[model samples]
Target: MCLIFRIILTAWLISSSSLSMALSIDSLRGVEKRKPNVIIIMSDDQGWGDLSMNGNPNLQTPHIDRIAKNGARFSHFYVSPVCSPTRAELLTGRYHPRAGVYSTSEGGERINLDETTMADVFKEAGYATAAFGKWHNGMQYPYHPNARGFDEFYGFCSGHWGNYFNSLLEHNGQIVQGNGFIIDDLTDKALEFIDNNQNDPFFLYLPYNTPHSPMQVPDKEWASFKDKSLIKLADARTGEEDVVFTRAALALCENIDWNVGRIQNQLKKLKLDRETIVIYLSDNGPNSSRWNGGMKGKKGSTDEGGVKSPFVIQWPGTISSGLEIDQVSGAVDLLPTLADLSGINYSIPKALDGISLKPLLVESNQKWPDRMLFSHWNGKVSVRKGRYVLDDNSKLFDLTTDPEQRVDITSQKPELTKALSMAVVDWKAEVLKDIAIDNRPFPVGHPDYKYTQLPARDAVAHGTIKRSNKYPNSSYFTNWTKNGDYISWNVDVLSEGDYAVAVYYVCPADEIGSTMQLSFEADKLDFKIAKANASGMINQQYDRVERMESYEKDFKPLKAGVIHLKKGAGELILRTTALSKTNALDFRMMMLTRESP
Candidate 1:
């Protein structure tokens, strides 16, 4: 069955089941009046209490706070314990595991290609769709934004970027240099997209990578809080140990707020503010220890502070102003709610784990449904009912009394715990049923990526046999030196064509003549080290964090001739053929350039 036809039938069935609901996505094409435009602005690592609206006294975020002041605020919003999974959940309206992303750059951080994205539904319904900022989901074709129903994508494909200033970014799959801070650049691109598509309804996803790691912020922004005396956060009620890191995180968030102001202002100026549904949220909990709505844990843990992100939505005239909805919502709810508002619906391979929040958002103080929300990370799962939480260890907590989750009350409420436990077991079974364990391979014959970098640090990225990083570039490949080591990259080829191969490594004078072979399917090509030293260049253009100097001195190049390739799913292997003087030269990455017709 064709996707459009399948969706049309599914929409009719689902809509018939609930006659009170709006029309399904597939039928939105004929509406003469413009549908609502959507702009989802998600921040990285900005916790529940990061905003002054949530009562953090260290910094001020008036612009972001305005969302809650002007629209509906979801006080108990939840997300994944990490960045990537939450992103997958938000895009697919399903649990992260169901979307095929278990963690960041590991356990299939790349979303499954077959899964239907929110962009797919909106684009199908005649909405121009674009994704700006961090797209931690996938780097390969079929999983990339352009392939996953997004008409335009401007951001890095990796899990995270290293540098924010004057960084190289992917603009519609082409590497384009971005000026100024990343947050500003992302918002500027979003404004440009909005301007270009003002005549039509558009869906814009802006996920900003701020306050997550590397702890780098603009000097002027940091200087404002750098000199302030260290003090405990009002909500935390305790002194923070790392003031510098927290201050930097705060400055980065405030910088994001400034950009949010830009977006909101642009919307109002274009008179699209009332027609666009603007949402504000964070990917996960705070990276540093500070006030996080008085919750107990930080990022990567299945705790309130870890997964709870502040979510505020403003759909002018449709959603009433200054209302607070205390429903327990999660990132999975994003897609469904967007679909409901846009009146687009479709049947996907996996059943959605989220319920639409359209009723609560559009109707004032509506009766919200109470459903169990489950979260899992690092082998531990946390399930939440109305006021209760059950962790994987069978420890239970009454969130009403202990929002911080400081005490485990499993013994006090064995019956509640038992029921929640059974629910978690069932939930996990449902979400993990369709998960594919194999790595989604990089595309070899795709036109989007001219050069593919197979790094050693990625979860699927590994050297079967090798030495470790001696001189490290935290963002690039590290392992090298073993005599018969081979690094394999799982990838999908969209077409059959020839490609030029290059091996990036460090070679000493004594081991200059070593050779490595690139093999795919039944074809193999060999490249020899031409020089004793590496080429004075760097493949990792963006810094994950702020840095001072260029770290490109140790890298040299080896040009391997082109090999005629048969297009299909296969592993590309860089195998050590013959060592010249010592072990295989320190391997960095293998680059493949797709040959043009």
Candidate 2:
């Protein structure tokens, strides 16, 4: 009996010791072997010279500089000259032209539905993915961020926003008012997302819409730059640099730096700093030319300043500190690089234009192949191979000798020039082969989406109605004085359902009784304006400089009853009937909530 009891005790002791040893090994593995979280912060229209680290003495950006200081910096990073094209390239590991993104606004900005996004790959790998801030991709479902594999999305889906201070924004598919300054509001959402997903592998894309235009900055950030004298001026070639505009842009940049610091602090607080990878870059060049490291051209050009962007990546305990990579890279490389770093197995739907930069990022003395990157916008194409660039005018410049691209070297190196020119022709025929007008109608009533917002930016004004601004991104329809004045949107409703319709407009007390009809093909909902909402112009106090876009007003929502939309393509028109006053309310947006299918 004693021997049997000893045998049972001995077996119990052995099992306990094995369990304790296994837990110790798992605890060590949890700290060292877990997948790293990724946070990519992209700024809109911020130049390479916008940071102090980039030799811009006018402003200081220590927080942003720290990312470069701690990890790797790309010396020759490139992107598109515009917003949407660059965004599309970053999302997909392909040229923007291949993704059907030819323009910044309207339907052209929408990426091809079949192309897979970086968020989609991460999300499919069980990572919590979210994007906060400007999403110029598309606004409708399937094309929307939610359908593009971001579990959460909070931002405006426009080329540019009218107001930046506490303006109307969207969360997923529902319209929600922003909390504070647009940049801060986006950062707040991003911090919260990080906090919630700290335990899990997460991919957070914080695309900050700032320093773009309608140049708005917070009071604290503005106070330092408003009265200060500027040493750095724009290129003397234009000789028309607005100092106030430059100051406003610098102020906005400083505000972005502060927000970047906030993100770093959050990561440290959550003890996820070492286990997280942070990448920072800009979508395009500076909107206005202002001291961009002697690089020619600004936002709209294919010159060095227009496409050259600062790319900084930080991953403590992984990537080496203060490493400088001189190899030329572009936005297209982001998807493949990130997927490789995370060690996630993802198969792209199509052949990727970009190769994984893992060897350059992680290994020492890695041999890289010479590659040519092409930049195209508005029918202009520029090819960059090695240190030479063939400009849009079919002129080649050796960048090693002339960084400003002032001299044409095509005659000097005829063979290289001829080869590059023919390559451009082949690229255009292949990549830009299908690049044409995107006549696809604005989609609505997506079966999976509940709320659909048809803003005036997407509307076409007919008769006497006109857009408030030439740039249709954030403009409103005005001059609807006559009964015949109407606005229409080419729409494709995906579901047969009754949608609770509402019009966002500003009507004076005198124009309160104006009758309006909202129609989609044969189905129409007619309603009379009962209440008057004369909300004043917003962003006046917030605007640091005169804006090119229209000053936004509080477009109050007025319920216009319900409308039944059939599943098909047609024009959704809004026409006034009994115009009681001179104008039938300044049109802004039409909101439709799916009620019944």
In terms of TM-score, the best-performing candidate is 2
lDDT (Cα, tens digit) per residue for candidate 1, span 1-597: 699999999999987877634445435654455789999999998888888888788788999989887889987889988888899999998888877787576326788877888889899888899999888887666567888889899887776555577666767755567878778888889999999999889999998888776566777787787766644452453235466667778888889999999999999999998899999999988887786767877888788888989899988888888988877888989888888987776666768888899988876547776689988886678999888888767789988788888789988888988999998888778766665466555665576555554544441334445324321222444344555567676766676778776665666676677777778889888877767764444433333234432243344446678977787887877777776765556665555667765
The top-ranked prediction according to lDDT is: 2
Q: Each candidate: what lDDT?
A: 0.76, 0.90
TM-score of each: 0.83, 0.95
State the TM-score for model 2.
Answer: 0.95
Candidate 2 residue lDDT tens string, 188-290: 9999999999999999999999889989878998899998788878877534778889999999999999999999999999999999999999998899868
Candidate 2 yields a Cα-based lDDT of 0.90
How far is each candidate from the true structure, as Cα RMSD in Å? 10.1, 2.6
lDDT of residue 282 for candidate 2: 96
